[model samples]
Target chain A: MPYISTKTNIVITKEKETTIKEKLGKAIELIPGKSEHWLMLSFEDNASMYFQGKSDSGIAFVEVKLFGSASSSAYDKLTAAITDILKEELELAPDKVYVKYEEVSNWGYNGNNF
Target chain B: MPYISTKTNIVITKEKETTIKEKLGKAIELIPGKSEHWLMLSFEDNASMYFQGKSDSGIAFVEVKLFGSASSSAYDKLTAAITDILKEELELAPDKVYVKYEEVSNWGYNGNNF
Candidate 1:
């Protein structure tokens, strides 16, 4: 694996989970990894990207979570394409948005495994 | 869980995952959730944040991955603190960096669980 993993989180107005899922699913599909590596995508709502305890101005930050697949060098092209899709689909400004990644191992889930 | 989830991805110049980890570890501590929740943290080497097939100008995006315990609300304050830490610790401009979170479920790591 290239071991090139990164993630960012943003807070968007509430909409269909499918909308977010579809957009992210497209990006995840583009990530550089075998189909079985751990690729995570998580979510948070009514949130804000705080800089010094406040919302990030002008731009938006997003966070995604996942549980499977890992990458050394996947998702670079996917993020770039995602920027475009967010702009075209959500009508958000490309310059005002970005992404990040966080991977985990041997962890728990919602009061379980940790 | 509050069902509030989001994520973004970016690329950065090659550096120690520990540096990124320290900045993020602080943020993870700040998330408003019960301890031992599923909060993922994965790393990648030599990456770049893309916006429509190019680098994001003057700003940074981050993606965070996970394996266990889902969160509906937590980690908000943590990302903000991380933003400050990145600026102070790394001397990075606050306006140029942000974070995203992705949570995963029923997943595997490396060539295992999918």
Candidate 2:
């Protein structure tokens, strides 16, 4: 399973949310064996966040968690795609966005480990 | 640095948000060398989350990211404490909450990698 969550200081209109979701759905394919069918997404708009000890500018933190690991090259590609998606949809500067990936060894769903 | 983010389907009030942030600040101490001074927290309430193909119940997904590594036992303790906090504050069942940890090797801050 692959999950992507975005937290931004800028307000995300419902329309922008749908567009970002769709873009991320396609972006997840950058990693082999990952697709939107099993993708879980969350968007937190107007989030209280700071960068460089300030929160005046627009900022977005996108987290991508996968059940297994991917190559560094794959991660690089995904990061570029994610940055582009946020920049295009939210107008966030590429430098103002942070993308993090975690390969989870233990994930629980429905009262059990996955 | 340590970052703890909580995403749930329940609506978190301003009062409850303060309480959860306080509790999480204390909970981060379960990992040695981590404290609230360098902690960053984000709460995504009323999130569209589903578990086991259902979204009818109160479900929480908590993610803890550390700049470095921590022991598995430390993670276990932190998980228990987080579950307790969410259950006590939000009345979510422990089984319905998932706490995941990630040890990050590269973290960015202030337009630079940390």
Candidate 3:
């Protein structure tokens, strides 16, 4: 399973949220074995966030967590794609967006470890 | 640096939010080199979440991200502390809460990697 959560300073409208979700669904496919079927998503819009000690401009922090590992090249492509999606949908500059990936060794669900 | 983000299905009031933050501030100290000073926290209450394909009761997902590694025993302590905090503040059962940890090798801030 893979989970992608986005926190952004800019407000996300329902339409924008849907578009971003769709784009991210496609972006996650860059990984070899991950797909949107098992991808969980979350978005926090108009979040109280600061970058470089400033919050006057739009910024986005996206966290991608997967159950297993992926290649560096795969991560590189996914990052580029995520940045482009934020830039296109939220008007956030490429530099203002930060995407971090975590390969989770242990995940829990349904009151038990997975 | 360490960041703790919590997502739950229950609505978090202002008072509850403050209380949880304070409790988590103390909880982070369970890790040897970590403290509240460098802790950045985010809470997503009333989020659309599901467990075992159901959403009838309260559920929480907590994510802890650190710049470096920590021992498993340290994680165990933090998990218990976090679970207690959620249980006391949000009234969520321990079994319904999932805490995941990520140790990042590359972290970015202020337009550069750390």
Give the candidate number with the greatest DockQ. Answer: 2
**Candidate order by DockQ, highest to lowest?**
2, 3, 1
What residue runs in model 3 are displaced by over 4 Å at the alpha carbon? B1-5, B9-43, B48-60, B64-99, B103-114
Candidate 3 lDDT by residue in tens digits, B65-91: 998888777877888888888888889
Q: i-RMS, every candidate?
A: 12.0, 4.5, 4.8
Model 3 C-alpha RMSD vs. true structure (Å) is 5.9
Tens-digit lDDT string for candidate 1 (A5-91): 222334445474457555665466665442223334444433333222223343334433334444534534544655665565555
Docking class of 3: incorrect
Per-candidate count of clashing residue pairs (backbone under 3 Å): 100, 0, 0
Docking class of 2: incorrect
- Scored against the true structure, residue B110 in model 1 reaches a CA lDDT of 20
What's the TM-score of every candidate structure? 0.34, 0.61, 0.62
Q: Rank the candidates by lDDT, best first.
A: 2, 3, 1
TM-score, chain B, each candidate: 0.50, 0.95, 0.95
lDDT of 2 by residue, B3-100 (tens): 99898988999999999899999989989999999899999889866544345789788888899898767887888888888888989998678777
**Considering summed lDDT, which 10 consecutive residues are worst modelled in model 1 chain B?**
B1-10
lDDT of each: 0.44, 0.84, 0.83
Residue A21 local lDDT, model 1: 52
lDDT of 3: 0.83
